[model samples]
Target chain A: MEGEEQRDGSRGGEAVNGSDSPASLDGIEAILNYEFRDKRLLEEAFTDASYSPENCSSFERLEYVGDSVLNFLITREQYFSNPNLSPGSLTRLRAANVDTEKLARVAITHGFHRYLRHNKADLHQKIEEFGRSIEEYPLHSNGMIKAPKVLADIVESTIGAVFADSNSIDIVWKIFKELMEPLITLKTMKKHPMTELTEMCQKRNLKLEFRDRWQETKEIEVLIEKQLVGKGSYRKKLIAQNRAAKNALDNLDAFFPQFNQPCQPM
Target chain B: MEGEEQRDGSRGGEAVNGSDSPASLDGIEAILNYEFRDKRLLEEAFTDASYSPENCSSFERLEYVGDSVLNFLITREQYFSNPNLSPGSLTRLRAANVDTEKLARVAITHGFHRYLRHNKADLHQKIEEFGRSIEEYPLHSNGMIKAPKVLADIVESTIGAVFADSNSIDIVWKIFKELMEPLITLKTMKKHPMTELTEMCQKRNLKLEFRDRWQETKEIEVLIEKQLVGKGSYRKKLIAQNRAAKNALDNLDAFFPQFNQPCQPM
Candidate 1:
């Protein structure tokens, strides 16, 4: 686990010395548009504990700080931008922006994953699968997809590193605000499929039930008024449940022909 | 609920026009040692939703902002102060400082509750009970006592109002760092009684169990090695459980003579 070249240096600019070349670090810096005063902060931000437990510090502490900073920044922005937004709405909006899937999307979209230093055997495959899964949901999968938390951790840790180095939140905001483009606004934010479906059913006084076949077949079926409206299957029960809800939402018109208005796509 | 005097004036200095006088506001400002740029923010911070709902705004929005600001401020302080602290420890420290019981203690210590404008019928009685209950536990009850959440919310809202007024976190910290005195450090922080009891039992290879009679009698009994060692009863089942755990910790020496070390009092 320890090598002379890997363990001897300051662990700064490890991006250049590790498996990736110097160009990889440069590419990430280009994406961030901010040069690190202490490149070790950057290295620490991207280094996972599984990578080199003895040589490199993990991103957990930075991620912790970054989580708070991002939450406050988003709260401040939305609080002022939407003066009429209630606390509940503000909370939902902030969650949409900073939740695991959203931050993971940010990391993947900017190719920050390419710069992450990790030795976990399955991370590459997980990232590849996440990349493929996200193509189905352009913005957020809500609870349907399980995003690798490491991706979000790196994004937060990077934010934390910038805030730590500059000691100026304004600079951090200026750099990340654009990179986190197309920020999920109230207009674009979608409720989770399960919530939407449940609420719709309740509003219409319709009985809704979910049949759990996940124990045997990894499948979940949604029933409305004793009619089989939707079925979904996935490796994870939660994902299957969410997918079933989404399927029910999509086929709502078919199930209830009297109300033919198409439910908006999530 | 509307009156001529309440409806005519700007809700800015309602603290003076409403139940309390200008002197009360002045006294609060003196306690805070920081005058608000907009007195309305101060008024808004203290106004509960139950008070003058038609004419005056509540502190919910400010509380929301303040909650975020406080979380960030504590995170930043702990992150910088304890360079080697793990994220888990940092989180626990932050939580110890900002949790409802801790913040409520701050409010009670400073007599901030005296100026809260609310129509809560039982608030006065609740505050009195909290005041009396806290006398037994000087630092924190750690889930043993039920602290009124409103007391904590007002403290946070005041922090938010100050931050919003000055648009400076430094000023808010300068004013609050002392008011929130005797901040619970790692040395002073106490684990929840239940957690302590469980850990002790597990360490000693002792079988510990909680017999819940809370539904019928509002009581919880702790048994070790099938011997009833401790029992507690409270109106709240959770509080009863915690007290039971505390009782078990207190009687550990009597139950096991080999280990005579007195358990640390929370």
Candidate 2:
């Protein structure tokens, strides 16, 4: 065990000690299960422009490259496996897997945020709120929760770093195949609450209207046939509207037991 | 030359002859310069769902995969080649290279559409119109001309078939590198006239409005402060609007010499 620890320590150096290293990229290699050939790429991946204004070169480029790599990798996998899947379905499946919420979840699950070098003031609070919000859905809140874009960016940048270091897509895939765990399969994927609610209402010929009180009250209410079915409030009007739609979906059964009954189109 | 033809002929068999063959996939291999190991994939790539209603399979799947492959290939190339290029510029460059019009031009240049098996009416007329329209703007017309989607689909499907056949991205790149010539680079890329018009108008504090006369006369007129500056008509309303914008841009200097002069904000 001592020999193993020494071998690992020798590879990671300052990362193993859990101390403030010169590079400040401690424990990242262990989390990724892959070490970088050029440690600077790793450092760059974690560094945000806000943290070091003097060094304007941030992870945007890496994030961009990583975004393409992730998209291609996911597309290749899903294209071959789902032989009968339509292009539309494939697109949705790919989006669900690599979207901001999904990538943010990946970052949090691996504790990637602990290593991110950013000076954004409200990021921590937003992340905390996201953490709490995700607990309700456990898989994906679709559009109900707001995910910090930086978390997703870091995850992409890390993938970009690995690709740039190795210059081999196969190697990147091998490393990330396991890292992106519990891959959102077609069977496990869920429709956005807004879409679900709209479809349900359309099928039943029920009148659906979103009353916007966002400017005055920062709240959105979903009304069906002049009766308030659900209400949700958020700082962002779009989020509030999505949440209201979700709330309406959740309470549909109790609010209207005859929701399934066909009615005259309004 | 006859011996070489015989050798090539043996490989492609029915695909080589100009006559009706078992697969009806003739002359495609010669055009592409890369023969497929699975001839059925070639046939499938060329086959439209309308051509074989019984099979109910089309080039859509292959086109989807090819679209992904082409996007990734362009991204990888541009990312490495233009180290100083920002993500926004990179995106625009990639889009200029892979958009429907550009790909359709590729199809026409290589005669890839000759082997396509589709039963759509008016396709020939559309292709001919596209051919004539492209003559005016040797490169891209930005948004002035409409491209037949089937032409682009075949190019993507062929690329997808080649990738699937070899299961090697490098091979696909190698085969397509020369085939996809005159790639739109930063130097060659031109902004859409609509975008240019909007920018020019905004800079000059000019109020530009598009009046839709499509329902009455299949025309879209561009008005600057209620004065008619340009008029354009097309079967498609969107195209008509774009052409009106382009016309407005062309006549901007003559119509409003005071455009460069700073004006009071509306």
Candidate 3:
């Protein structure tokens, strides 16, 4: 047993004593046994950037690969899930989902944070400088940060590890799905101002313009072909424009549709 | 030889003629033998996205793994080379070096393009739609539009494959270094506008504002601050705003340090 411990410890640099290692690879082990299929991949997956280059492969590299895999998977899944959404809508959805906060959250939920080994002091100092809690740090906290370059590598490394251990997509997806379920709430996905505005404008064939009438209080004026519809100050112009556009769209949908078509046009 | 050909054809799910089989294996084997220590990784590296769900293993998944590895290699190489650059500058440098155009160029130079296999129709359709030429497309172009994605995947897969075949980073780096050498060109990496503007503004301690002013004529007046930057008429305010901002930023570098520095009193 001691010899076995020594081999596993040295196999990938840095073996955790009893307290640090998870008791049941129940969550991670299933992935190892079924998904990774290759032990090298499993070793790579659990690897954090802390490992010395001479002793072990760092998860940093795997995290990079996992990021794209996650992106492609999410894009494919979302596209299929929401067939009616335009490309722009899908893009926003992806941005919201794949951004650091969400990805870290997903990573954490999967017990991924436990496996990660990075510079703790650096992460803590960064959070302090940002006036955020240490818990909010993506590396330490909810794993939500805009660091695609860093976080993606960690994520990919995990995937690589999972594959190494178990070597099956089905097992990997089981863990991935659990982690992602909360973020993929139907209610959260529905509220996108840009998507709503674009859909409205596209249907009506009316150009939405938030014209800036600089003379009047540095306010933004909304004009639909020389006729003023609504106006607001500069700060609120984006919202106002969207509102004005939305209102105009709503009016068009209600009024114009009555005259043009007997039933609601597809 | 015939038996070997049959096994290769069955494993790869490709129709193979006995005569053509040896020639095919020669190149694949040469790359595989030299590059990877694990043959499974080599097989997975060559596996295309087209075969993903239909087969238990797809190159798409491996591509996912490979992309991160390539990114890490490139990023690490660049960061180590230029220690003085800020994170933002490093990011831009990385982007400039890793974009599809650059990756495709690197991929071709390394002869990695020759090992790729894809459906011709899908490849042609993507090229036409995106206006990418064959020369512009990286390997696995049929699956992903971005060249870096394909390039990163191929690079990673090749590494994985080589590791599978030979388990040697020395062998992999041999090919990787050759491909990455051209991307290290400092001349190709231009400073991003935002970075320059931020740096210029910081030196001057000047707050930048984007304002839209009106002219007496039919065209709208656009200004960075008070100066008349552009006259009436272009629909895209974004273009005009950026140009005005650029002009303001250009004149700033010379005068900016004088106002903010401790050497000169405020």
Candidate 4:
């Protein structure tokens, strides 16, 4: 589906027409001033497939690498960020953070949309304006569908660029954390296993216990109300134990919804 | 590690101080060329840590990524190069080809010894001959010991450089194949399981039969000397008894050392 004109000119600009645009991307850069170190990568990150070949190389390939890098970085960050979070919870959180829509939102918040160069032929190019366009173009058949993929691609490519430019993991984390600030709220961080289990136990007026004991082999065990619920050997480590406890807690609803309910003198 | 001496000047030309005979790196470029598509990467390959940061960056990191990329590219190439090869065999071949010492030897054959540069304080710097210089310096060390970890790291970096620069799987394989040419002889290729299995069956005058027959579902089974060895089924296809024998014949292990011996009724 092709159209002659759009209400907004998000894609078309002097830049697309091979003319210099007076609007410098300096403002966004200042806010995200981590210094990507690799200028080539930064340019590539903003580059869209719609741009002519001579203008720039698309961020598609960088995005591919970036997507994996982000998964790895975020997974690692989440694991170490809150030691109390369980593996399953971390996994779910990771999924939520890395899902396309979430990342697209992050990209948007970081002023990613302003830097994009869109197509003049299409009427509905801006991602935010998606009401009548959805009805008119029907994403599956719409030419604009490629835009999201490209935008997401740019997001990942920027990450790859950041990683390449700087060897420091801390610096990279700072950039990611800043971009994902809106999503990674204190509420999200506090909703770990410890909090979840505590809340669940409180709601039912059930007594909860977490006994941490170390064995001769330096193994850590987390017992709940005299039950041998979770154990972590030296090799398995604390992370494993935390994850086990979280998993065990998640299943409490189906198995033991009423913790205070007295058993019939069995 | 720093010492200086002045030499006598001749009538026409004379050696001055700091003129350490102008390193006779005659054929070093050729060796680097074999592994890298661009001569720049080759230059980087031979660039030891000795050069000041102003001169050039060492090949240490490139070599790290190169080694992994080389393995990945070669493993993929070998998989497709010989479609009949099993995963295990391909893995062994990959391992053998990518060993550090073996790659060092490849560097030697390619005349990499002539061009090696290292910091004077580096343990490898105390050398008299080019070949000995290579052994003493172990450029792959990245200013560390020639231990397993360092060696593995260097090998990977080199592979990564080639993969990134050349971006051609075929060229990468060619470099890898050349490096492994001495170790992987035509004779050795014949000893590969698939090849040996085929030959052994032929020598014993045994016919490999793969019977694909099943009442409930279509199945394909490999038989050496009419003895079933391995089985595969396409029950979902629901096209059983449809040339199961022919499919089995193509997948026969040509290099299997003990084909159908278990099935023979002693």
Q: Isolated chain A: TM-score per model?
A: 0.87, 0.86, 0.49, 0.51
The alpha-carbon RMSD values of the candidates against the true structure, listed in the order shown, are 7.1, 5.4, 15.1, 19.1
Per-candidate TM-scores read: 0.88, 0.85, 0.37, 0.35
Interface RMSD of each: 0.4, 0.8, 8.7, 11.4
lDDT tens digits by residue: candidate 4, B176-229: 565545654223532323344446566776776545456544565657766665
lDDT of 2 by residue, A1-266 (tens): 12454334433223112322223364677767777888888987888888885664688888988998899899999998998999899999999999999999877666677677777777777877776677787788888888889989999998888988888889889978887877899999999877888888887877999999988888999998778999998877788888999899878888898875666566
- Candidate 3 overall lDDT versus native: 0.47
TM-score of chain B of each: 0.87, 0.87, 0.50, 0.44
Better of 2 and 3 by lDDT: 2
Q: lDDT score, residue B28, model 4?
A: 33
Model 1 Cα shift for residue A16 (angstroms): 19
Higher-scoring candidate on TM-score, 2 or 3: 2
lDDT of 2 by residue, B120-234 (tens): 7777778777877887988898988899998899889988999888888999898787778889899989999788888888878678899999989999999987889998888
Worst 10 residues of 1 chain B by lDDT: B10-19
List clash counts for every candidate, in order: 0, 0, 49, 31
* Candidate 1 per-residue lDDT over residues B44-99, each given as its tens digit: 89988888855887889899999999999889988999999999999999999999
Q: Best by TM-score, which number?
A: 1
Please give the lDDT score at residue B164 for candidate 3. Answer: 37
- Candidate 4, after superposition: displacement of residue A14 in Å? 21
fnat, candidate 1? 1.00
Q: Which residue pairs show collisions in model 2?
A: none
In order, the Cα lDDT scores of the candidates are 0.82, 0.81, 0.47, 0.49
Query: Of 2 and 4, which scores higher on TM-score?
Result: 2
When summed lDDT is taken over every stretch of 10 residues in candidate 4 chain A, the lowest stretch is: A137-146
